[model samples]
Target: MSRFTTQLAAGLLLAPALLAASAVQAHETGDIIVRAGVVAVDPQENSGNVYVGGANTGLEVGVDSNTQLGITGTFMLTDHLGVGVLGATPFKHDIQLKGVGRFASIKHLPPTVTLQYYPMDKSSVLQPFVGAGLNYTTFFSEDLSSAAEGLGFSDLSLDDSWGYALEAGLDYKLTEQVYLNATVWYADIETTATFRTASVPSKVDVEINPMIYMASVGYKF
Candidate 1:
């Protein structure tokens, strides 16, 4: 056979393989779907700040109880496997050290993407999922004693932190567009903040309870 004919025949033999692979990928994609859910967060960080105040300054501040509206997108990779993206607004709050004329809050946005596996069908009324992932916490917009009158402005000590994530959740499908979900996840979000006006910088070895009671209504095609 001529060289051109030989190449043409080889391509013909390979065409079926390529077509099969494409079909497999397409099936995987169709089996896979994206699910978005609402995430509400409440976090408590420990710290103390100091400002020059004589006698006493109610430098009293409270724990940062922040409830945020966040979203999570999920994709099913297989009948028993899935992957997802969990994103949320940056969390912010202030701390008031009693008797000290100083207060501050650490702020950050935590965006996490995880690979999950489920043992139930999408059409199943109840589906549960477990996953592992990486968590990136970016701290920003840190401010001090904004509510504390006469409290001079000082710098905040927060740095970007990275950690591992372990998650487990259950999805109860009420309907295709409405489902109830509950998830509990743990992350090692240990970060250090150096208060410029305090005795020293504080290192926070805090575990963000990404663990939340989740309930959401999702859509499927």
Candidate 2:
């Protein structure tokens, strides 16, 4: 497994310990919770072979990790059910061409909406929830590195992606209105990268299924 994957697994494994250290509390209906903190985007990416002039290049690509400011708000419809919106600053990732060094860079925004279900009752201090939702990602501000341009690459563009997202999170209440939150989400994202090499525009299919992690402080009102 990759280092990021291992770290994510470790974080999830420590959830029970987190619960053990905090009081159990449940959210009530008509409550609004707002959270803000840092979020990391780690893409477990895969790509098809690149082509140039209708010839296979036998090269694969990968994406590097990025962290950005994350903000979210949740409104409780019932004690156990809530609707939430997740947002973040644009995430920037370096597109690495394996063995051939850095290739390009891209920035994207992933906005998500989900329905969350909390399993505990109102008196509990630690809230653990599961959510399923939709993720819409838009790619922009693509740039080709100097090296890539030197290699005859230009006119790069990445297609927008719309996919499903799954989330698991835990909230530990520190006071009546304050809490610490830890959450992880996985999004199924796919895109087609089109660029010109030697004046020939070529396309590559890429799957950038990313796992997002967030740790934040929240307020309930």
Candidate 3:
């Protein structure tokens, strides 16, 4: 299993014991929570056939996953509702062509804003929340592989994307001001990659729907 999965399983196994220990106030109106941790973006990608000079090339594109540092902050509008924003360091992904090896690398940032609902009482130590939001992904520093350069590929770029985001998370209070947190998000991301091959302009539409996971330590203020 993945590291995130293993950690999540361990956390769940420990939840019962933790929950039985004591009741603590987790969220309150006017509170702010900040969390920091590792985050992974795993893409479920699909792409249209690469088009060279407006003609189909019969080859599809793919994108590999990445991990990076993540940070999030939430402002409690009420004990049961909050607005949260997610940020991360730039994530780098390898781009591949079907039946071919990796040909490029690209970096992107996904910034998300969500409205979250915490259903449990404010006194509950174990806080579980659900959220819905919007994500904006901007791609930059797209570099072609050496092999791709030799094959006449140049000027790689991917268009920016805007899409919906969904989230679920759990937090276990470790102290009055600190907690252990785990969160997962699903984002709908699409982009068009444009470049040139053998002096011919080329483009391919790509869907990079990704599941994002994070395990964090949070502090309330």
TM-score of every candidate relative to the true structure: 0.66, 0.87, 0.89
Model 2: lowest-lDDT 10 consecutive positions: 17-26
RMSD of each: 11.4, 14.2, 12.0
Residues 1-221, model 1: lDDT tens digits: 99999999999999998866543221123443434555655554433332332222223334455656666767766767777777766666555455664466667787787888876644456778899999888888766666432443355666777888778887665554455667766665656554433333233223444444345555544
lDDT (Cα, tens digit) per residue for candidate 3, span 44-87: 99889999999998999899999999999999999999999999
Q: Is candidate 1 or candidate 2 better by TM-score?
A: 2
Candidate 3 regions off by >4 Å? 1-23
User: Model 2 compared with the native: what TM-score?
Assistant: 0.87
Ordered list by lDDT, greatest first:
3, 2, 1
User: Between 2 and 3, whose TM-score is larger?
Assistant: 3
Looking at candidate 1, the ten consecutive residues that score lowest on lDDT are: 49-58
lDDT of 2 by residue, 3-111 (tens): 9999999999998888656644459899999999999999999898888777888988889999999998999999999998899999999998777899999999999
75 in model 1: Cα distance from truth in Å? 1.3
Compared with the true structure, the alpha-carbon lDDT of candidate 1 equals 0.59
Which residues of candidate 1, in runs, are more than 4 Å off? 1-38, 44-63, 98-102, 121-123, 146-153, 198-210
